[model samples]
Target: MEQIQRSNWKFNMILLGMVLLLIVSIIYSITLGSADISMKDVYQILFAKITGNNALLEGFEKGWIDIVWLIRLPRILLAVFAGIALSLSGAVMQAIVNNPLADPYILGISSGASLGATLAILLGVGISFGPNYVGISAFIGALSVSFLVLLFGSSSSRADVSRLLLVGIALSSLCSAISSIIVFAANNRNGMMTLNFWLLGSLSAANWQIVKILAPIVIVISIFFCFQSRILNLMLVGDEAAVTLGQENHIYRIVYIILAAILIGFIVYACGIIGFVGLVVPHIARLLVGVNHKRMIPITILFGGLFLLWADILSRMIIKGVEIPIGVIVSIVGAPFFLYLVIQNSGERRQ
Candidate 1:
């Protein structure tokens, strides 16, 4: 809350601490999974593999190298970026609509993306697109549906908060219903099982190929968003107020929506619908850093990465042997937190 008045040195120190903490957490997290691997061994394996020095890999078990280099690291990295992407998107979107409750779920983007992926998995919707076509299918569906939402909300070229939200809800219902119809009609038990597990979300399938693709896009978009602090702040004031400040909220809202759409598309493509990370993280960040995007975005991004990284770790060990789906873990935590946010927001409105 004191971010605006906090000294740059203090803020910078905190930021550096969070960065270092995320690094330390990543190292620690990699060592704790089913396989018995030490932090020292984790470091040696990373150094050897990353440096392409086979000689350094001499004494270690081949299975340990496979686990560290191929399995755990990419999964952890996916969780980090997915967390960052959702949190950043949620922050910007809450600003765009000037609504604290706005997120991928509320805006229907997740359902739309889910519908796309369902089609890809069941019906081979984007098979022609080659490798990772499912992700491509999801990207197309999210972008297309969000554009329609914007178009409907922006009747006569002006998008309003209420219109956007209402249309989003309607599309969410429609998309979910359509996806259900497809699943039932397909009547493929194995595919149904696949879809159910996928909808629940897991990082089990994470690989270096996905990490190589998703990490760069997320980082690039995150950097772009930091530079947009000014525009994001303007968005909170509503179009009428923003007009007086000589900013056209319509165009900016459209641009922000498209960016958010693209961001959510790729996220759903990577991790499935890990719901409530978006809804919960930004509000927590706002409480810590206040409403200033400049003050809040970096903290939001880091906090998000940390939250999901730990959540993934919890998902692994929560059960005696079998891992819990990461999405279920988040929903168990997030649903009640959302109720709290609603109550808090209402209490403020009453005052």
Candidate 2:
């Protein structure tokens, strides 16, 4: 009992710490960018906005309000919510497939989104959707590919881990080839540049409109996944074991994959394809807290949010006047961490 209490106490402490860190990170990130805004000014604008008290805005410059409220804060919040969505999807995928290698992109969702965005930019497909057509197309592509994956993987029997992964890889290759062909045949330099940027990912286009759409979806899905923690834990134990425990692993697997795909689709729609967070954050969470989804899910969400928030800050400040692609930054950081985890896991298996 004492040991259990100690564990619970430690978990709560870490959770609180993560929440505070995320808050601080957002405040600090708001102070970055080309415009020079002080922490005091940032807070004043935020307070005024929150309280609807123009009195709090008296001493602040108008530009600071616009920059903080219209520009920086939206991007930061998008990063936070995007991180949460991606990481939770990763955590759930890993458990469902019982493979640490499983991530949101592992199922070809990113490739599909890239294809959709490519078609939209290069050929003006889906232009009728207005200014955000590219994102809308990407979401449609992701959802379509997700359904195909589930359909094909489960055609023979229950969609086992190996079968599902194979289907995902095959479809991913097909999507990538199609995207390449479209880019090559279009011969539009501007379209190619746009496609490259979307493929690499960026939070530069973030605004309140995006945050409003993505934030609520991410929060609701995250809470829903939290309630499925017990089932997720069972999934990691293998299908036979789960069946013996009276859990219908296949039904749950299908549902989880669909839910994860929806989360990824929306995130891809909002921020393009920011990789590595989904793949690495969950493993990092597993290391910090054990494999219990109940404890691990919350921590994964917080860490993922903090990780991306800082990554966005670095992307903006890494080179003056030139913002690096956020996806590239994540891959640079995530690649090393992923390698280390693989090597460490391999060494442990050998031992």
Candidate 3:
């Protein structure tokens, strides 16, 4: 009992530490950019906005107000929510499919979104949402593909993890091939280049509108996933074991898949396709808290946000004036970091 209590206490401390770190990281990220804003000014701007105090803003130039409030804060907040959505979804996906190598995109969400965005860009085909209709199209494509994948996977009484994975892979390849065809047939070099960049992912389009649309959904879904830790843990134990315990996993698996699909769809729409956060952040979270979903879910959420926060900072500042796509930054860093974690874990096992 004492040991159990000690473990609980330890996890609590770590979770609290992560929450503090994430808050600090978000604030720090907002202060970065070519504009040379200080932490003090950022805070003051935020305080003024939050409190509706015009007096607090009198000392700052109008340009500073626009830079801080209109640009940086929304971008940073978007990064936070985007990170949370991918990482939390990744953790849930790995558990649902019972594959350590699984990621949110492994289920064809990325390819579907890519196809949708490609069509919107190349053929001028999409639902009219705004200036950036590509993202909406991507959202539609991602959800459509996920629905098909689920239909195939659940054709049996229960969704077989292996079968579901195969189905996702197949559909993903089909989407990618179709997207490639569209790109090939379109002779517009500029549109193709734009499509290429969008696929690499970026937060350059971040704004108050996108953040407002994304934040509440990510928050609500994350909270829902946190409460499903019990079923998620049971997932890692395989179907027969869960059935023996009187829990039917098919319904749970289907529901989880649909919700995860919705979450990833929104994330892809918000930022083109920030890839690695979903694949590796959950593993890193597992290292910190072990495999218990109760603990892993929260850590994954914070770590995802923290990881992307730093990645976005690096993305913008890495080149003096030119900003690299955030997806490029994530892949470059995440590949090495994930490899290091794998090596270290393997070495420890050897001991």
Best by TM-score: 1
- What is the lDDT, from 0 to 100, of the residue 291 in candidate 1? 83
Better of 1 and 3 by TM-score: 1
Residues 1-351 of candidate 2 have per-residue lDDT tens digits of: 999999999999999999999888887787887987777878878888988999888867778788999998899999999899889988988887787876767678777877887888788889999987877788778878877877886645655666777888888889878987888898878767766776788888889998988888889889998899989999888778888988878888778777787778778777778877888999989888788999999999999999998888888888998899999999998788777867886888799
- Model 3: per-residue Cα lDDT over 1-351, one tens digit each: 999999899899999999999988887777788987788988898899989998999889999999999899888998889899889888888887786656766677777877887888788886467776866787778778877776786655555666777888899889878877787788778767766665788888788998988888899899998899899999999888999998888788778867777777777767877776888889988888899999999999998989898888988887899999999998897678667756875788699
Residues 233-309 of candidate 1: C-alpha lDDT, one tens digit per residue: 99887778888999887777778777777778878888877888888988988777678889789988998899899
- After superposition of all CA atoms, the RMSD between model 3 and the true structure is 3.2
Q: Lowest lDDT 10-mer window, candidate 1?
A: 1-10
> Which model, 1 or 2, shows the larger TM-score?
1
My TM-score estimates for the predictions, one after another, are 0.93, 0.91, 0.88
2 versus 3: better TM-score goes to: 2
lDDT of 1 at 189: 87
lDDT of 2 at 292: 96
Minimum summed lDDT over a 10-residue window in model 2 is located at 153-162
